[model samples]
Target: MQRRFLVGLIGANIGKSLSPALHEDAFAAAGAQGYYHLMDLQVLQGRATLESLLVAVRTAGFAGVNVTHPVKEAVLPLLDEVSPEAREIGAVNTVVIGRDGRTAGHNTDRTGFRRAFEEVLGGKAAARQQVLLLGAGGAGRAVACALMDLGVQVLHVFDTDAARAQTFAADLQGRFGADRIRAAADLAGAAWQAAGIVNATPIGMLGYPGMAIAPELIDTRHWVADVVYTPLETQLIATARRKGCRVMTGGGMCVHQAAEAFRLFTGLEPDVARMHRLFNEACARRDAKLAAAG
Candidate 1:
């Protein structure tokens, strides 16, 4: 008999996530019986806590779960062990349930973003340039670490929550150096000096629709990247493109990260090109649906 794998994604406002389609299709192609589910917090209506959800899924024979958005940091304490990289980033986006019943947390976000950036933008120029990064949450931390790894000379960090941004900057400064990372008090000022800008917040996602930075701040001199994949072309990306700035969408990160998560869940190398094709197909379907509704 062939083995079967079950996995899920846990997050709020994720009804439109493409993770399930991506993983399930990969599993089918790999000849495994796989079922990927979405455990939307908003849909759960508090019926189960994160702890309870983890327990329920594991008990029900799930192989693992992907953590997202608001729960990425919150899920850390629930894991039996965390990968060193995840510990360093203070976030967990992937959790695997071992056969021995121990759950280990690992973050694939950094690797995902790094791979996407390198693939889309030749790393040399971007690596040498200073970057203005928006947000300091779980995704932000991952992107910041990836940017530093890519050789960004300086990272100007900003978040709506000033204290959160300061704390995240302090943490990164301690790890990298005070010279490499600093919290930004002025968005326009930081963008004026940066060669690139990245948005790692949920601001431009489907449920949350808005640009993280002022459109006027973006110019032809800067490159822009966003991590919100639901609306592949966010207002930020659109604005930056109109200004002739190079842009990277959240779709690449979404596909790359899902590829890593697929490997962790099934221990099989997924065809990344196929995964990208599937992701693009899913996005097209989403866009078509929205267009029809409109």
Candidate 2:
């Protein structure tokens, strides 16, 4: 008999998320009965709350859930337990609910970012000594640690919310040491100083459509990476590539991270390559539909 698994993602402005297609494809290939649900906050309104959704998923026999955006950090205090790594990163992107209804939080973003960074841009890009990280939100928190582990001697984190950027940078500074990380209050100045850049913000994604760093700020010498894969290539990535900078799209990170999340949810190893192919195919199809509609 095929094993059954139920999993989902929780986030706002996520109707365009490729996660359902990616995971369902993986499950089918693995010969397992699976349902990948989307608990989008945009569509939910008052129909449900984050706290209520967790309880519902646990009671409804869900294997786990992936949290994103505004909720990743918010979900931390709510989980029954959190991995030390997730705790240290100060965010939780993945949560596994036990059969006994106890929920445990984990973070695959760190390893996922590192693996994807190495895969797409190579280790040479990560050791740039200094990198500008846009957004100090949930994803940024994970990517920040990844950059540090990958040998980034200095990381300048920036967020539209100055306080968030400062607080997050301070937290990371304590762990990685004050000399390595700090909030980049001057976006323009930091862009000039950093050798490479990583965009962990949602700004360049489908719904949020704009470059986090202005086009003028991107230089030919800098390398760039983004965490938004829905459009496949974000504006920042496209701009950087045009400027002759080495670039990486969020697709690789999304695939590698989802591969880890799939394993945690189903105890099955997902074919990362297969997921990558599916992701591209799905994005192409989605773009085609949008183009046709217009």
Model 2 TM: 0.97
User: How do the predictions measure up, each by TM-score?
Assistant: 0.98, 0.97
Each model's lDDT comes to 0.92, 0.91
Those runs of model 1 whose alpha carbons end farther than 4 Å from true positions after fitting are none
Task: Give the least accurate 10-residue stretch of model 2, judged by summed lDDT.
Answer: 285-294
Top model number, lDDT: 1
Model 1 TM-score, 2 decimals: 0.98
Candidate 1 on 1-294: residue-level lDDT in tens?
776999999999999999999998898888888999999898887597788999988898888999998899999999999999999999999999998778999999999999999988768757778899999999999999999899999999999898999999999999999999989998889999999999999998887988999888898989899999877878899898999989999999999999999999889889899999999989999968866875
Looking at candidate 1, the ten consecutive residues that score lowest on lDDT are 120-129
Superposed Cα RMSD, model 2: 1.2
lDDT of 2 by residue, 67-128 (tens): 99879999999999999999999999999999999999999999899999999888877784
